[model samples]
Target chain A: MIEALKQRLSEHFQLTNLTIKNAGLAFLWVEKHELEMLLRQLRDFEGYTHLSFIIASDHIEKNQFKLTYMLHNYDTKHDLGVHVDISRVNASMHSIHPLWAQAWTYQRELKEMYGIDFPESPRVDEDFCLEGWDDMPPMRRDFDTVKYCEEHFDDRDGRATEENRQTMKVNIYPERGE
Target chain B: MNLTHDFSPTPEVDLASGKYVKIWHGPQHPGITGNMSLELTLCGDEIVNCKTHVGYLHRGFEKLMERRTYIQNFPLVCRIAVPEPTFNEYLYSAGIEDLAGIEVPELAKWLRCLNLELMRLGSFLMWLGGASGAFGMSTVYQWTVTHRDYILDLFEEMTGARIYHMYISPGGVRAPLPDGFKDRCLMVMKKVEKLLYEVETTVLNNAVFKKRAIGLGVISSDMVDAYGVTGPNQRAAGYARDTRKDSPYLVYEQLDFDVITATGSDAFDRTIVRYQEMHQCVSLIRQMLDRMPTDGAFHTPTPNVLHWKIPAGETYVKAECTRGEYGYYIETDGSEYVRRVHIRGPSYTHAIAVMEKLVIGANIADVAGLMVSLHTYPPEIER
Candidate 1:
């Protein structure tokens, strides 16, 4: 079922790196400019009406952020994930709020967590979850969470930290050691 | 049926003119299911604009999962949604299994299904209590919560914990069903079935519940896809889009049950849909108990935990959570730790965008009932 859809979609649009994970799931890469039109076609014409989720994975080594828009076709019970790679420097992508009202929330979250810009999304600038989060976008691969915790918070006195549980257990009970 | 109120422009309220008052609805209120607030702009007891506020319970489980190994993340995922933790445990394990190419055993499959069905029954009972309590029926709250405790007792026997049962591990389940557990489970099912009847008589048939819930928070069928609504919320809106029926996972394909739905698309309709699903849960449990394979291996062995490295791949695994379509999108990097893990809870949209739109033009008193009727958990949204 997904093979025929991919064949029909590749005929018109430029689809690259198609990965058929299973019979009911597939992911394909498309240009950022082609995402909106492709999603609109899928939602309206291809029976992929439900926008399951939109998530971003930061590929810092490649200086790119991969944004996946998971679309579900209720009629066929298949999931088609549309992946779009945008540059990591001043990342921005075309917003799909016009296609799905819930896209704005995902866009807003991507903006706050990964510092990706979605221009003209409703309330995109406002805080979604992290209020008064003045530091770096916490989700970026560059942000070191452990360092931030050590710098901002105080550790409790007499707190024991163990790096390895097996070694600590052996040290505590040498008679019962294996 | 007229949904013009949802699309109509919001009337601006000027606080300087003293015509409207702004209030925070929750974070520490009994009406809210968890620790989250709604910033409401009200004009004489009618809410004009509603903006949902979360992050009070945001522990950044997604970011935390990046540093933890595959086995370490098993316990952490259950904390994402307090009410329904088995969905997280199952989906997390299922996503890992999908990417790692690990097929679970037959007996494990039926056990996982039984665990999930029990979780659904327990979570829905809690929600039923909250929904009734929001509507000023405290008696139903007491009755349902006590019965919910009966379900919790079953969880305690099965998984050794009441709330966060990290029993559904990656390769397979943690253990087999205990001895003599079948008859004990059937006993609790009988008690819960009796409780549902009492609830139906006292809460569903009550005048106050119908008066407050029938026409409140109507979600048009058109909004189900656009706003990403699912589970009972979308089912109540006249669409029978259930993950269990559409894409059957685990033992759902073997189970015989119909997708429950309602046509009104209102609070009362959603309650009826879920209430019927509880009876469906009872039947599903009975079917699994009768059909499950006896005396077989319950778990599949995996690689060593500390040095395990999954081959690089990505997969999104979802399940029919009591709330809606709960999922986990996992991307592996062929290393000891995961690259990216995004937990998609149904409340992420139902609480924010849909709640913001539904609460507009609603009375102040019905806001809690409206929110509860949507059946959202706040930790899942912020996570």
Candidate 2:
């Protein structure tokens, strides 16, 4: 199945990298410029009809955001992950909502959560998974969730702090000496 | 059926202007199953457009899982899907085990299957009540919920809690089966199976239910492929796309079962599809009880969860959740904390994309019924 996918993708574009992560799971790192064409072939010609999900992971150390478009085929029950690296400074990608209607919801979520831009998505400008507030996209790696929680919400009064909690863990389940 | 009707509210212009009145249909009403709203634009009794609004139940679970240790994530993921909580736990545990290179024991595999099947039965019972009640059959709700509590009693005995069972964990299950647990579970399941006949007569065979659900919210196989509608919704459309059958997870490959499908592809067909699945769950549990080894290792040993660390890797584990496919894409950075955890719940597509398309041109009275038939749990969508 992996060989078949590789042969099929090679027909459309130059296959730069194809890594088989696990049995029935494979990943292809495509150029950010060729993502739309790659996904179009995967959906149309490669029998990858189901757009399972779209998720972005912020790799701040490399100054890149990894966007994965996960697709599944109904006949073979195989999964393929198409990974694209976008510049963290200006994260923008073409929307595949025209290919999969479900992409509208996922693209809207990515736009709101990671502040990524999908230029042509329907309802991409509307509020998604969050409400009216002016703040940084919370899912980014540098969003400082603990600090935001402390400022916005009140903590429980009787809970132990981090240091005390570590001590309590040792006291409760002491390690056994062999 | 009359598609247009007179409203008591005064109209500002004649019918030629193409003006429609908008109404908020949810966020508080019993017609909605969860904390979600649908903004419906209605011309008389026919709906012209609908926009779904969620995020009322968003708890930022994805971020919270990243902050907490892998062990602490067990309970949090279960809360993502309220009705059938064990599927979330199962996927998270399986994903972490895959990343950390932990092999689940054979006895634990059967135990986990038992737990998942029981959860499916419980969720279908709740759906039976909600689907019937949507069409003004309140008695079926009373009957089905009462029988569902028996399953909850079994859950309370096996795991300490009824709704959220933090029993399934990374290495294996949290604890072994209690003494005589199988017998007690079988007893409850038998009683539930007997009562299913009554449910069939009251809900599936009821004339009113048939009239209300026969052709409502009809979904085609083409629509299922395009929008990714799954589980009972797709099965009712005559496509046997079950994850258990397609990608055999756990001991499901070893066990014998059948995929239930119907031909109607309408609201009534979906109801009947789930109504028939209860029998499969019962027989599957019976097979588990007979085939499982009595005195075998139930859980694998692991490092203390508080200090456990997974190696740097990423894996996706999926299972047949009650609603549809439940998947977890877990990544670890070789640290005590998880790097990323993205949940691809079935409701994400069922609630937003499929519901948006199905709601347009539907009668206002059948809108709630259509939503109920899709079985979209809202928290999974917003989370």
Candidate 3:
């Protein structure tokens, strides 16, 4: 399995650092350029038909967000975990949706939740997060959850007020039906 | 050969004729189960068409899990499959354990099976509650819910939380079974058997239930595959697929129990599949208790998960839930949190794709019954 993935990935793109990880279910590496070609090979060649899930995390101190591709093999009962890091500065990626149909909602969700840009995705209009809003993506490691709670969260049943009175107070906060 | 597929929009009927009636089963219908709306177009005693609407109970749990820690998501995973929360915990823990190279002790594995089977029994009882109510058998619904409480109380005693017991850690269980847990198991199994008799006479044998369920929402083996329906619904259709038997995880392989199935492939068969499976769960739990060793480490010693960073890896763990095979695909990048978690809930294939396509022009009256009979859980769908 390791040799197969290594050869398959190496055939498409030059791999820098490849390691068999997560129970040897996948060949993990930091692919420099031909990301699309490698993903295409994963989809068409290896029959890793399912795009299991994609997760993006911010390495705030490092100024980079790690984007991981969790891939599933249809024929084999093994999962392929792929990791790639895109600079937090750009927050963009060439969409992998052309290879997997299910990646649409997940990528769109990434845009909403993490404010990452999928530059090549044509159908990026769907709103996955805050409507009529202005704020950093909530999923970003930099996004302060406590501050967001302080700003938008209501002290329903006087709970937040009583709890936060020991910490912070909201002077004039408009509330609605919870 | 009665495959429904006329996706024309339904129009409201005029009430002035006195023959046409409009009923809003919705965002608040007991039969609808979750917060879902099914606008039924009825022409008095018969349904013309039905339109299903979602978005009432959308919690964006998948989105929420991304925000919380791996351990914190344990409590939240329960909310995904409300009726069978432990199934979610089991899958998630198993996935992490598989990835983290954690080997739980033998006794702990048996206890896992005990908790799993108990959860299945509890969930099946809840399904009986909903399925019975869907068919207008109120007594069965009431009796089943009241009786299932004992199982939930047992869960509460074991894990503090009655409904969402975040007890199944990735390493193993939160703790070993409480003292006299084996006696408690025996007590529950005996009680469940007696209650099973009461249920058989009062509900399962009820003529009205039999008539309504035997023919309504009938499906076939081909239909099961086409619709991707599994669990009791598929077993009721005579399929040989079951994670317990086929891909036995945890301590299921050693446990002695039959994969209860039926050939009718109708509402009655599906209900029976669940009913008998509850008994099988009892039998399985009893068998597990007998075979279970008295002592072993309940949890594998792993790096304190609070401070633990998963080695960059991925693992897909699959388990048999009350419904069917529950698959969890997890990816971690040597972090305190998971990279991403995608749940391949069998219900997604059954509820939305299958239910939507199958219930197109069926009797609107049978729509709610059909949904419950299908064992559709909306969180699994929406997640």
Candidate 4:
């Protein structure tokens, strides 16, 4: 099934970075310029109709964010993940909500969490999953959760803090000195 | 893509001669399921527009999981979906197992199936109570909740907890089944089946329920595809899409059962589909108990929970959960901690996008009932 999909996809579009990572699973690094065309062909021609999900992973080391669009083709019973890397400085991508209405929620979430801009998407600017949030995007790699919790919320009197966990780990495993 | 749904936002129209009354439906109301609010624009008794507001129960599970190790996240994952927690555990474990190349024992697979079917039965019982109770049928609600407690008793015996049973671990189940567990499970199934019959006769067959629910909240077939609605809600609309049958996972491939569906495509039909689905779960559990091996290892050994590291890879595992297609997208960076974990719950779509679209033309009184029919778990949507 993976080979058949690869063949079908290669026949019409370029397969520059296609890799079959696992059986019944394939990964393709889609270029930012060809995202719209690739998604349209996948939905229209390749029969991958179900837009399972769209998620963004922060890759701070690589200085880029990886956005994976997970899709499943009911006809072929195959799962595919289309990965696209966008710059962290000015994250922007075209909206595919026109292709699938469910994409509205995903794009809205991405906009809120990663500060990614989707040009021309309807209602993508509206707040989702967060209300009155004005800090850094909480899902980003740089958002320090421990510090945020410490500053914004009160701490219990008897609970362990970050320093306490580190001290306990060092005490338990003395051979691996910190 | 279908390309039939209007993706554009609803235009600002002058209703009530530019005097439309806007009201908040929930956040604290008996009609609501959880901590979520719906902004409803009402002109007289008709609803003009509805906007769903979530995040009341959001804990940022995705962000939190990235900071914790694989095992530390196990107990936290189940909290994503409070009503049906095992499905989250199953999907998370399945994804980690796939990424780490952990081979599960056959006995473990069968045990997982048994636990999964039990979770489905328990969740549907809760749904039965809520769906009928939305229409003021408190008798059905009380009976189903009382029976659901029996299933919770079975869970407590197995996992030492009732709501969040952290029994489903990475390589397999956390513990072996206790002695006489099968007999107790079978006895409970018999009781649940009898109670289900009474529920059908009293609530489902009543003429008043039919009058209120049969034609209300009808999900058109085209809308199911356009909005990505799944689980019993989509099946109630005559769509034969199910992850268990389509993409067979766990021991579901070896089980024998039919995907229950209905043609009415409305609240009543969706309720009936869930009703029949509970019966199907009973039969599946019976088959699993009869065929499961009597003596074998229930779990595969793994590394220490605090320091285990998975290779660098990404995998997406999905399960046909009680509510819908529950998917977990996992990415590891060859470290003791996870790089990212994205949870795609069906309620994220059904509760927000689809509910907003369906509630526009519905009557004000039917809004809560319609939301109930969709089986939207608020925590799943926010998390």
What TM-score would you give candidate 4 relative to the actual structure?
Answer: 0.96
Error of 3 at B281 (Å): 0.5
Q: Which residue pairs show backbone clashes in model 3?
A: A22-B313
Off by over 4 Å in 3: A1-152, A155-178, B1-24, B39-51, B219-227
Where is model 4 more than 4 Å wrong at Cα?
A: A162-178, B13-19
Chain A only: TM-score of every candidate? 0.91, 0.90, 0.79, 0.86
CA lDDT of each candidate?
Answer: 0.90, 0.85, 0.71, 0.86
Between candidates 2 and 4, the TM-score winner? 4
Cα error, residue A23 of model 3, in Å, equals 9.6
Error of 1 at B35 (Å): 1.1
Global CA lDDT computed for model 3? 0.71
Name the TM-score of chain A in model 4.
Answer: 0.86
- Over B1-383, each residue of candidate 3 has an lDDT whose tens digit, in order, gives 22122233356567788876667777777767677666566775666655455455656666567565676677788778888888888888888777778898887787778888888888888888888778787777777787789888888887887888888887888877788888987897888888888888877899987877777777755455334456787789887567677656787777777777799988788888888888888888888878888887898887643455678766667777877757777767777777667676766556544555456556766777888888877677556
TM-score of each: 0.96, 0.94, 0.73, 0.96
Q: After superposition, how far is residue B14 of candidate 1 from its true place, in Å?
A: 1.2
For DockQ, the strongest prediction is: 4
User: In candidate 1, what are the lDDT values of residues A42-61, reduced to their tens digit?
Assistant: 98789998888999999999
Positional deviation of A46 in candidate 1, in angstroms?
0.9
Q: What is the TM-score of chain B alone in each candidate?
A: 0.97, 0.94, 0.90, 0.97
User: How many clashing residue pairs, candidate 1?
Assistant: 0
Candidate 2 chain B weakest ten by summed lDDT = B1-10
Candidate 4 on B1-383: residue-level lDDT in tens?
A: 36556866576867557668789999887678877889999887788898888888989998889888787798899999888999999999999999999999999899898999999999999988988888878778889999899999999988889999999899999887899999999999999999989998988898988888988878887777567788999899987888999988788889898888999999999999999999999999999999998879989998765568899988888989877889998899999888999888888899888888878878888887888999888898777
Candidate 4 chain B weakest ten by summed lDDT: B1-10
Residue A12 in model 3: lDDT: 61
Better of 1 and 4 by TM-score: 1
